[model samples]
Target: MTDRLTIRRPDDWHLHLRDGEMLKAVLPETTRHFARAIIMPNLVPPVVTAADAADYRDRIMWAKPKNSDFKPLMTLYLTEDTEVRDVRAAAEIGLIHALKLYPAGATTNSQSGVRDFKKVTRVLETMAQIGLPLCVHGEVTNPEVDIFDREAAFIERVLDPIRREIPELRVVMEHITTKDGVDYVAGGGDTIAGTITVHHLVINRNHILAGGIRPHYYCLPVAKREEHRIALRAAATSGDPTFFLGTDSAPHTDAAKLQPCGCAGCFTAPNGLSILAQVFEEDGALDRLEGFVSEYGPRFYRLPLNDGTVTLEKGPPVEYPAQIETGDGPVTVFDPGMPLYWRVVD
Candidate 1:
């Protein structure tokens, strides 16, 4: 049996590092293994302006662990009022890597998301011209659409139209959770790609509903059925350039998660790589792990691949902390519900 594996350090194509105390607590979990992450812009006010993105980037840099080479690839939260000139300027200065689209009331702090897509036409056209990718939440907020069907519905009613209008615009369907999402990206050309989260790969809806509603397993774009999980694993391990890792490792205090209407996100940053190693090994696709995690994401973003290497050594099952303390409160780490024998040694 293979005992050791080393590959180029990975980059998280999608991530959420909230501001202040929470940022400090969670930043290290990602930086320890990932060289860079495309930071989410779903803050309370949201990072809408280039100036807002710059300020948030600075805060992330300050909150990042000392001497950590963790680069935060910032993104702007797209709203109806987003301006074309600002989008171009943000890309010109490298202050923003992509524009995030959150359908109004879609997820946490997304009340300010785009409501009138028509208002952002100039912005989208400009993005197409400049080659700035759009990272989308990929869900519809209509009350009539079943929560489980929102993703597929959004693709049919929303994404397809947008792509038809702007064929050159690159789009990264962030944290895709369904077989519909997988097939959509697989059939698309080079202008589109999808990111699959580690939690979704391991847990299905049953993990949350079957056992009396485990709150930590609850997240937006909630996990789908076992068939979807199987499809996600197939895409992740298939060495297809269209799919990559983007652990939407959103951290909410246990108090927030356990509330009447809890926040939506899973804290998987701490043990994401470990869990991924386990997933790939079980599928007998160990050789493709590096390509999924390290290679495909950078390729989609058109950024250079990371130079550093991380080694995972297989041995006895490793233990991960149940919760990480922050100034706000304790955030629960994702529990894979099984032993994790593959661990990052460096």
Candidate 2:
């Protein structure tokens, strides 16, 4: 049996490296394995302008480990007042890679997100003209829509209309958790793609709510039903260029996560690659793992493939820390529940 595999170093198409202490703690987990990542923009105040993006990028750089060549592709948070000129300038200078769309109140720290899509038509048009992608947290905040149905609702009510209006606009639907999401991106032509998180592919709603509420498994665009999980697994392992890896490795302190109104996210960065390797191997798609993790993301972003390589060696069940300590507190690493037999040996 094949025991070892190597591929181009991976890139995280969607990631959340929160500022300050959290950033310092989690940055290395990703940089150790990934060559680059498209950093999320939904900070407390949010990275709303070119200046805000620049400042946040600087902080990320400072937090990065010494001599690590990991590149942080920054993004700006899209709000109603986001200026077209600022986005154009950010794109032109390579200061930002994309702009994130969070329907206001849709998730954590999204209070400043867009309430009316009409207000951002000029910005969207400018993005389409300039070829900058819009990375979206694909969920609707409408109270009436069931949490499980939000992603499907978003495609029909929000994403489809936006894409139809601006056909040239490139979009990366970040951390998609539903079959509806997979089907939409599969049918969406080259202009659109989707990012599936490692956690979603491994755990379904049962992992979160079956016996009790497991807060760490709890994440925004929260895990859906088992059938949807099967669909996500098929799409991810299919080696389709329209889908790729974006471990929305959001880290929240155990204190912050285990509360009455706990925050939404999974700290998957620490064990992300190992879990991915296990998942791919279990599906008999070992040959396609590299394409999912390292190849398709850069091709869609129009970035060069990474020169270096990382190798995974299969073995007995690998052990990873249940929680990683940070200045803030202990952040729980994602537990895929199933024992992983692959480890990044290199």
Best by lDDT: 1
lDDT, candidates in the order shown: 0.94, 0.93
Model 2 worst lDDT run, 10 consecutive residues? 208-217
Predicted structure 2: lDDT = 0.93
Q: What lDDT is obtained when candidate 1 is compared to the true structure? A: 0.94
Q: What is the TM-score of each candidate against the true structure?
A: 0.99, 0.99
What digit string (tens of lDDT, one per residue) describes model 1 on residues 8-49?
999998999999999989899999999999999999888999
**What pairs collide in candidate 2?**
none
| Alpha-carbon RMSD, each predicted model | 0.7, 0.7
> lDDT, candidate 1, residue 303?
94
lDDT at 271, model 1: 95
Which regions of candidate 1 are displaced past 4 Å?
none
